[model samples]
Target: MKMIRNVAVGISGGVDSAVTALLLKNKGFNVTGVFMKNWDIRDETGNCTVEKDYEDARWICDKLKIPLIQLDFVKEYWNEVFSDLLEKYQTGYTPNPDILCNKNIKFNKFFDVARNRFQADAIATGHYANTSFGPYLENFKENTNVHLLQAYDSNKDQTFFLNQIPQQTLRRCMFPLGNYLKNHVKTIAKEASLHKIAQKKESMGICFVGKREFQDFISEYIDDKPGEYVDLDSGLSIGKHNGIHKLTIGQRCRIGGCENAYYVFSKDQKTNTIIAVDSGIHPALYTDFLITQDVHWISEEPHELRHSGVLSCDFRFQHRNPLITCNVYKISDNRLFIRLSVPLRAITKGQYAVLYSGEECLGGSIISYPGPSFFALNQQNSIIETRCCDLIALTSGVQM
Candidate 1:
């Protein structure tokens, strides 16, 4: 008798995950659905959607005649993901908690539980990315040398988010929806009589927080400190902002009664001020070089970067522009300095700089700083000089 492989699927209460469980079940695997509860926070109206999602997950599992497992990672999420996110915001960096969540919680903790506790031979998800054993593994029966590839649906490819996941974890993972498009996945769900979930709108914003306003959600943890908004060109105060932490690079200013809409060009955390520009197309908003720390590679560091000293990169996920050809310089084993082929707009610090060669994701790092455009630096220098003069004058008057 052929032994059935036990596969655990992460049912996220969405059409994609529901379809994934269905596909795996049809393939003769002993399928189990797992729902992860990572956030317990409620919105301003005291509403929480976790129960609704759990209901949906249970409904899907019941329809499929499979068992459902619910696990709470709330404490783990707060400590590992939320804490790091708050610290990054305090330091004026926009960090991606989704990336960290996949690394620390989903792949690490969830993977461990499914394998050890549930005795699952493999774990699966609804992510739109492909994974396969690496070449030269035909002779080996043991799972080894896994490669994460771009999904068949380029529009929904999630390799960027999964770049930080380790190769070993990826080897034991499955993506049932990898080869299918989003519309096709919905079609499968509808055919399987999951019409309610098929038509359910996709969730957006942060992963765990669901649909809350970003500014309001962040303010709950970090206090709001009001600051001045200065025009970079004129070095004059234009408007007042609620707080520098509340804003991000390249965000539009809601400051009313302006002839032209202003965009956040830069931020000075020390001064608690934001610099604005009248036009989004300002040269000051773009940068050609960025320095990053804590870089991670999925399989191994690129051979070209080590041998030839250059590799192409995608600084941001789902970026519409062409891939950036860059020269990679190693600052340390875990840090890198990348020079881009073209200047990118709003290269925010604390964002991941994911690298790729062809269709393979090479992994990425958190951006420490974006090398500012010459025009932006000049404006900042002028402001610093004026502030120094003002301080000196104040000290001289005290002496007199």
Candidate 2:
């Protein structure tokens, strides 16, 4: 609807991003595809999977007749994303590296590389997210305020992963697939003679760890730090693990000859111990509050929180989990204290807690540590009735 603008589309060799480039071309924008190589490691089979992905990305660029640029961010990724992930793992924290990748690499370094190096007027990605800048940045104008929102396809919405990036970075971005469903994006790709790309399996979570066992891949980075499996109730050692990094909270770590199956309730890095409960759904696995010192707000801080020192909204620390009601208390400019409507299972420290008011993404903060578990509280006040539950109950499901 206006003068043609040069757009740098981050093509990740997937169906969604391939279609993203096609959409930009169809919209009369000067589309240029850039494929970023963030990781250089091969899989267990000694095959460089990233090479195959790059080939597919090249094919798409050829078919679309748009110039493709390849950028190597392996160094930046190692320093910005991987090192921190390893540190968190070593400390017995279950961190989501995807969100960090988005914040530091995609929206941060990629934005700078695309704009300064390539003369890109704007940036585009295959992410399923939207902005107040309009779906395609069609309504974007200088100095106008921007707000991140969930994609039309809520199932594939990636706003949680994007909540940490800077506000100005979002202002100059375009999400062409924001309003399109996964199937529809595939249909568009197929109709445009890019069916093979469309048929490519979607990349979920981290890509560098492709098809490799997480523990095996991670072992290459972190050494084996032996730890003990202690019973949460009796405080007795029931089992031992070669590495605490290999285990996570809420995971069923049952050992033979034990009186009952046990689930991980917590991890003590200093003591090199993994605390466990007899039942997977033991009340010890649930918590209703958490504190965080790293909180990022989009656009501006909410007026309600600024004035009243509190804000109630929907929250979910995990992307696939359903949004739950919560009240956010502003402890400081950089700190938050969140109280959930219902006690949730395995609310681990180091995971990001994203809060939203309806569809709009307000902000997110890292879960520094969870409050006392129901089991811990029961010892003091006998609040929750404990039970021996099955492994199936150990999920993100709410606990009343």
- Estimated TM-score for each candidate: 0.89, 0.93
Instruction: For residues 1-400, write the lDDT of model 1, one tens digit per residue.
Output: 2232888899989999999999999988899999999988877778778888999999999999999999999999999999999988877888888888999988999999999999987788889888664211222234456677788888888888897998778877888778899999999999999998999989876865657777878888999989899998788888898877778888998787778889998788899989999999888888889899998989888776777655655555333445667767887788898988778888888888888776877888888988778566777899999888889889887432
Q: How many residue pairs clash in each candidate?
A: 0, 0
Per-residue lDDT tens digits for candidate 2, residues 59-115, read 999999999999999999999899999999998888888898989999999899988
| Steric clash pairs (candidate 1) | none
Q: List the residue pairs that clash in candidate 2.
A: none
Clashes of 2: 0
